[model samples]
Target: MKIHNFSSGPSILPKEVLQKASEAVVNFNNSGLSLIEISHRDPAFVEVLNAARSLTLELLDLKDKGYSVLFLQGGASMEFVRIATNLLNKKAGYINTGNWANNAQMEASFIGEVQEIASSKDRNYSYIPKSIHIPQDLDYVHITSNNTIYGTQYSEFPTVDVPLVCDMSSDLFSRVLDFSKFDLIYACAQKNAGTSGVNLVVIKNDILGKIEREIPNIMNYSKHIEKESMYNTPAVFSVYVSYLTLNWIKDKGGIAAMERRNRAKAHLMYSEIDRNSLFYGTAQQQDRSIMNAVFYLNEPRLTTLFDDWCIKNSIYGIKGHRTVGGYRASMYNALPIESVQHLVGVMQHFEESI
Candidate 1:
């Protein structure tokens, strides 16, 4: 039996997607070669790359004007630095919602001036900060669409006159979004998209020509955009896997369908959390994440006992981050409704056992 993996990253992918990926690993497109061994420059891999890029745009409903998608290596972490180096000239505004958002601010500070417009640090990142005051003169405003660690998400993004850059590492393609609002969006293809190794970047074409700073060709978005994401050898296997995942998304009725399923899963778990006497939902109710539902027990000892119970039941990766000792169930796109139901059963059983 396959274990229900709730890991935040390298997270669960659809079983069909995994099976298809396994076949490709042995004989990609019946090319008589493993996808891992194939040349990135080969026509077969080139088709994979183009399809991946095209499907990403199609799924996001992005048009040609001002937006270009690039499949690059070096996860979203690298883009934290690259975005600052390429875009931040005088000043940039950052919203510190969680660890990843703070990391982006720290990286931007290394390159240039980065102002923290708003932060939820005081609340232990349990809720998204509202009333962010972006500086009028800042070059760009950066926001993390979802806080993976804290289980808080922005239901609606703030309005900014300047260019908007978003680190959508956790929630990319999880729902229908206004891609045109963002001047640049970057995501590590591990959570909802695909496995690790490849980073998907979507940037506005017009914003490419505005960078006056002298940076390496690799750091420049324009370079990758111009070369069709082939400025250098890409993460071919990850890209191909991502393409398969995108196809899976399309087959399952795209983002709208996934959004409905995600909401249903979130409701099942969160409703249990609210109703249970032993457990308490961690994140604010209004800003709770559909991807990661975090909660804690009233009795600290119950936390350990509950974790052990989950493990014995073959439900894994529900332990919360060390920074915040609790439980987090990462219900990514591929986590089945059955798994969420199983978890809810565990929660109910634990209450009865106590």
Candidate 2:
């Protein structure tokens, strides 16, 4: 039986992507060298890097838009520090929606004055704070597009006067949006892009060189731009696999297609949760994530039975984040509608048994 992967981050990837990545491992481009063995500065590897950068820009409709795309080491976790180190001048504004948002804000506070313009933390991050106030006093406004832990997402982004930055780790390329709205956007490749080695950063060229802080060579966005994301040895296998994943995403008709399919998948699963007697959604209906659909089992006593059922049915990665324990069905770009339907079937069957 095939497993329906619902793992969030370092999560599911397309079968075709997996197959191609596997082939490259043994013999990269028929060069008799594994992708892991190839040097980052190798001309062939350079093409791969360039292609990945170009495709990222193309998918986001950001090509030639003066934005520099960089696939850097360190996950988005590392970016929490890098963002402030590079962009924060006097102050920056952060919206505390969930764990990652708080993490970004905490990291930024270490460098400069960071303000929480709004937050859903008071309610355990079950809902998005709809009433937002953007202060013109800040240098830039930071937002997390989706909360992987609590399952809340911004269906519509705020149009702020300050430069808009987003940590879109979980939901990047999972749907359609106006990419031009953001001055900076960063995401870990583990979720929708590829395995968990490289983090993608897209920053407007004009935003750099404005900060007063002397950024270290490694943390400077402008320096990374100058080096073309090869300041040091890059994550060769992760970047190559990400390149293949991006190719698959483009072949699937870009972000527009992903939006349609992801919407359908989320709707199917959420509808079951709402209708089922055994479960209910943890996040508000309006703010439910199209990528990570989180819910709760009504009766905690049956949790073991349900877990056994899911395992018996070849379901994987449906367990919720340790921060908020229940269930999370992460429907990233690669997750098929059938897998979601299968999970829904499991939910219904369990409900019937209950």
Candidate 3:
């Protein structure tokens, strides 16, 4: 039986992208060398990097907007440090939405002052904080566009006078947004983009050079930009697979089409959680993430039964994070609506049987 993958990270990817990537691993572009075996400086790999960067800008509609795209080593977790090292000259404001948001603030605090401008921690991060007061004195404001574990997303981004930086690791290419609103956006490729090991960072050219701290060459965004994301040997396989996925997104009509598809899946998943008497959603309805639909079984004792049912039906990766124990149906871009329908069918069957 086929598995319905709902893994939060290192999640589902387009089948076509996978097929092409697998082929390249053995023999890239009909050449005898595997993609992983090729030198990072090889002209073919360089073209892939350049094309991927250009495609990212094109899809975000950010071309010629004084923005530069870099697929750098390390994950978004690494970016937390890089972002602070390069940008945090003075204090920065961070909106603590979930675990990742809090971690980002903690990382930045070690570099300089960090103010928790807004937070929903009082409610266990079940909802997004609506009332936010960003201080004008802040060097920049940081936010996680979507909380994968909490299943909450920013329906509308906070308006800030200071430069805006967003860690959109989980929901970067899964929705359509006004990309120009952010001065910097970083995303790990493991979720909607590709496998782990690479992070995509889009920086506005003007955001650099203001900090007085001596940023080491490796941690400096400006240095990475100067080398075009090749300051060090890049994650070759991850970047290539991500390039293929980007091509898939463009061919499928870009971000607008992705938003519509994701909305449909979320609606179906959340609708089941609401309508079914056996279950209820964990996150606030208004702030529910289109990428991750988190819910809980009303009869906690039936957890094992539900897990068994899901596994029997070839449904996997529906378990929630430890912080919020229950279930989380991650409906990413590559997750077909049919999979959501299948999971709903399982929910209905389990409810009826009980």
Candidate 4:
């Protein structure tokens, strides 16, 4: 049986991406070299890097729009520090939506003064707080576009006068959005892009080198740009797979098509959650994430029965995050609607059994 994958982050990837990447692991580009063994400076690997960066810009419609795309090694976790180190001089503002957003603010504090403009933690991050007042004096404002752990998403991004930076790790390329609204957009390539160990960082070309403090060569944005994202050896496999997956996305009608499909999948699962007697959704109606649908069982006694059923039915990684108890079905850009339907069938069947 083909197992359905539902883990959040380092989650599902396109079937074609996985298969092509597997072949390249042994022989990349038929050049008698494994992708892992290839040098970053090699012509073949350079082609992959260029393709990944160019495709990202093309997909986001950021080409020649004062933006530079870089495929960096560290995941989104390290970007919390890199962002602050490069941008934070006097202070910055953050909108805390979940654990990752809060962690980003904490990391920024270690670099410079940071303020929480708004937070939804009091409500257990069930909803996105609208109408946040961004301080005029801050260097930049950071927001996690989607909260993966709590299943809350900003249906509409906050408008601010300052530079709007977003961590789009969980929802990048899963839908269509106004990409130009952000001065800096960073995403770890685990969710909707590629596997882990690579991050896609896009910066508005003019957002660098205003700070008075010294920035290390490695952490500085200008240096990376100058080196063309080749400051050092890169993650060859991750970038190659990311390039292949991006091609897959392009072939599937790009972000517009993904947006429609994602909305349909989310609606299907959330409708089941609302109608079924066994489960209740944790997120607010308007703030539910299209990528992650999180809900919990109303009757706790049926947990084991449902779990056993899931295991027997080839459902994998539907368990919720430990910080928040429940189930999270991460329907990324690559997850077909059939998988969501299969999960809904399981939900309905388990409810009937109960």
Candidate 5:
């Protein structure tokens, strides 16, 4: 049976990307050496790394004057601490949207004075907060561009005079973004970029030398920028694969094409949920996530049955986050329309059978 994958991270990737990666793993670029065994310093590997970094900037339409892109080892979790240590001087403002935002805020607190300017915690993050007040004296304002687990996303970023730092792990390349608006944007590659192992950081050039805190060389963004993200050996294989994925995105017409596909996939699932009498969506209609759709059967008893039915039908990873238990269909960039149609059919079948 051809299975459909809906896992949020280490999630689905383009079929062509996977096939190309598999070939490279055995004989990279016809070098007759597996990509895993190639030296990071090798010309082949360096080309891959440089291409990945360059393509990232090109896709985001970023100019060289103000921005620097770094492919780092630690995931976005590490960036939470790094951002605070590097950017937060006296105080920082953060919008607490969901679990990941709260986690990022927690890490920032350990480094300096941090304040939750606005939060959706009261409503269990079902909706995005309308306003965030950034204090003029604060160093930077942080926002999670998309809430992966809570099924909420910011349609428009909060406007603040201060620098804006965003953790865009889940929705980094899914839509077109104004790269200039943010001082910093970091994301773990597992979601839309590639598999787990590498994280991408795009930071403003001006923020590099302004920090007062004694940040370690490894944690410092400036050091990574200076070294060209070759500070350590770097995740060579992951970076290579990420390069392939970015190339795939470019071949598919860049972010504009991706936005149309993503919007269509989300509309397909949400339309079914709205029309279906036996199922209900969990997140607020206006703030519903395009990446992850959270919904559940009207009859509580059918939850387990529905989950089992999905598994039996070779539909995978539709289970919701444990904290917000229900059904979550993570329609990532690489997930085909057919997979989503299968899921919708499953939902319709369950509704009829029940």
Candidate 6:
């Protein structure tokens, strides 16, 4: 049976990207050395780094716009700390949408004062907070673009006077957006971009060197940019995979094309969740994520039955987060619409049988 991967992180990649990356793993650029075994400083690897950076800026249309792209080691979680260290001078503001947003806020508190400008946690993070007020005193405002665990996302990012920072980990390349609005944007490569072990950080050059607190070279974004994202040894394999994926996105007509495909997949999945009597969505209809759709079986007793049916049909990783305790079908940029159609077929058939 063909597997339909719905795993959230280290999630789906284009089949072509996987094929190309696998070939490189065995013999990179037709050289006998495996991509993982090559020296980071070797011209071959350096070219990969340069191309990755160049392509990233090109796709975002941020070329020559005073923004620098860096593929640094450590997942988006590491950025929770590095962002505060480099940017937070006296205070920062965060919009708390879900688990990841809450974690980002908590981590920034360790560095300085953190004001939760607005939050949807009062309603179990089922909706996006609106009419957010960003104080002028804040050094920057931070937000997680999408909540994978809760299946909520910001439909439109808030307008703020302060420097805006976004963690676009889950939905980085899945849609079109005004990429220039945010002063700093960071994402883990495990989702739509590529696999694990690396994070992409795009920073505007002017935001640094303002903080009074001393930052270690390792945690400093300025230092990383200064070294051209090679301040130390980088995540070789992960970055290479990310480069391939970026190429795939560009060839597929950039983020606009991705948005159309992703919307279709989301509509397919959410339509089933709504029409089928067996299940209902968790997040508010307006706030539901196109990337990860969280829903639950109406009849809790039928949970095991549905799980068994999905497994028998080769559907995997549809289990919801423990916090939500239901089902989540993550529809990423590369998840073909057919997989969603398959899941919907299972849902409809199971509903009728039950």
Q: How many clashing residue pairs appear in each of the predictions shown?
A: 2, 0, 0, 0, 0, 0
Give the clash count for model 2.
0
Question: Would you list the clashing residue pairs of candidate 2?
Answer: none
Per-residue lDDT over 227-290 for candidate 3, one digit per residue giving the tens place of the 0 to 100 score: 9989999999999989999999999999999999999999898889999999998789899999
In candidate 4 the C-alpha lDDT for residue 236 amounts to 81
Q: For each candidate, what TM-score against the reference? A: 0.98, 0.99, 0.99, 0.99, 0.98, 0.99
Select the stronger candidate by lDDT from 1 and 6. 6
User: Model 5, stretches more than 4 Å misplaced?
Assistant: none
Model 2 Cα shift for residue 241 (angstroms): 1.0
- Could you tell me which residue pairs clash in candidate 3? none
User: Which runs in model 1 stand beyond 4 Å of their true positions?
Assistant: none
Candidate 5 residue pairs in backbone clash: none
**Pairs in clash, predicted candidate 1:** 66-204, 66-205
**lDDT: the better of candidates 2 and 4:** 2
Candidate 6's error at 327, in angstroms?
0.5
- Cα lDDT computed for each candidate against the true fold: 0.90, 0.92, 0.93, 0.91, 0.89, 0.92
Pairing residues by index, what is the TM-score of model 5? 0.98
How far out, in Å, is residue 330 in model 2? 0.3
Q: Which regions of candidate 6 deviate over 4 angstroms?
A: none
Candidate 1 — number of clashing residue pairs? 2
Model 4 lDDT tens row, 1-354: 888988897888988999999999998889888989877898888988988999999999999999999989778878899999989988899999999999999988889999999999899999999988878998999999899888989889988888999999999998888899999999999998898989999999898888887888878888999998999888888888899989999999999999999999999999999999889999899999999999998877778888899998899889899988778999999888999999999988888877
Tens-digit per-residue lDDT, 130-220, candidate 5: 8666678989999998887888999888999988999999999999878789989999999899888999999988976787778789998
Q: For model 4, what is the C-alpha lDDT against the true structure?
A: 0.91
User: After best superposition, candidate 3 residue 275: deviation in angstroms?
Assistant: 0.2
